[model samples]
Target: TLPVLAEPRAAQDLGDWLRELQAFNLSAREHAHTPLSDIQRWGGQAGQRLFDSILVFENFPLEDALASAGRSGLRFETQGSTGLTEYEMDVEVSLRQTLRLSFTYMRRAFDAEQVAAICAQMMALLGAMGTSPAQTVGSLSLLGPDEQAALLALGQG
Candidate 1:
């Protein structure tokens, strides 16, 4: 069975997790979209607040690579998040020899096996990063899967 963190079983911890989830989204989006050079220009942060908590596997963009492929061409994309940050990914398919083709995608690959491997790896890293139930600080119940999903999206899960 997939290992799961039981809900915090405390209201205060859940509340803290919620707030952290929100902040995580804001920071993640800012980090994901801004290019490395621009990030260098901005002192490494855009000073935005995190938004949502849920990490709905989603898409971002395939502008640069797809544009190189030209219009009316095939393009594949995928999306995922660490417990702290969200990401958009594209698959690069290439043929090395007449009978050999290979694919490399860093985000959530359209390929199921790749996706599973990366997701598991990401979740493990998230755990290593100390992103479990946070201090709640209020009267509330334990955070649910819904909240946990959000927390995971923040690159904090």
Candidate 2:
């Protein structure tokens, strides 16, 4: 495990947090080069006690290029070494139930309703930041006025 920074005040600023996160990432990558045999041995010995959940983030730079180039001629091969199915194959082989959330920053059209909802939430979050800039991000309210009232009522009940 990487060492946690003890500076909460420093982490309150987004820029500082980002810098610390980058430092942690560098430390993690430096420590990540363990032998395959050691990993296999650990997994083999770790019998039935499997982790129930995991979060995965993968970077596919070519995906944007492929999307821009148009995917009509693009054949999605399921068995290739570097194909999109690699992650699927891992999931199948591991027999793990995974829920993946993919967020991309490309100029692709999304469902209008979903996109509007996302934008509204972002606006709400920005408004929250404006009202309470000094508060920690975790303490900010992301809910709309109605939802906040409902939640307050529920809490009172």
Which candidate wins on lDDT?
Answer: 2
Model 2 lDDT tens row, 55-130 = 2344444445567566677654324343222122111111124323332222233455654565566557656766
Query: Which ranges of candidate 1 are over 4 A from the true structure?
Result: 1-14, 26-31, 44-157
- In angstroms, give how far residue 16 of model 1 lies from its true place: 2.2
lDDT of 1 by residue, 6-116 (tens): 343345465466566567665676457555455444654355422212233323233455666666576656466343323333222223232121223334435668555
Query: How badly does each model clash, as a count of residue pairs?
Result: 16, 0
Q: Model 2: residues >4 Å from true position, as ranges?
A: 1-11, 35-51, 65-100, 103-135, 141-146
CA error at residue 30 for candidate 1, angstroms: 5.7
lDDT of 1 at 42: 61
Indicate the residue-level lDDT of 143 in model 2: 81
Q: How accurate is candidate 1 locally (lDDT)?
A: 0.43
Lowest summed-lDDT stretch of 10 residues in model 2? 86-95
Model 1 Cα displacement at 119 (Å)? 15
Top candidate, metric TM-score? 2
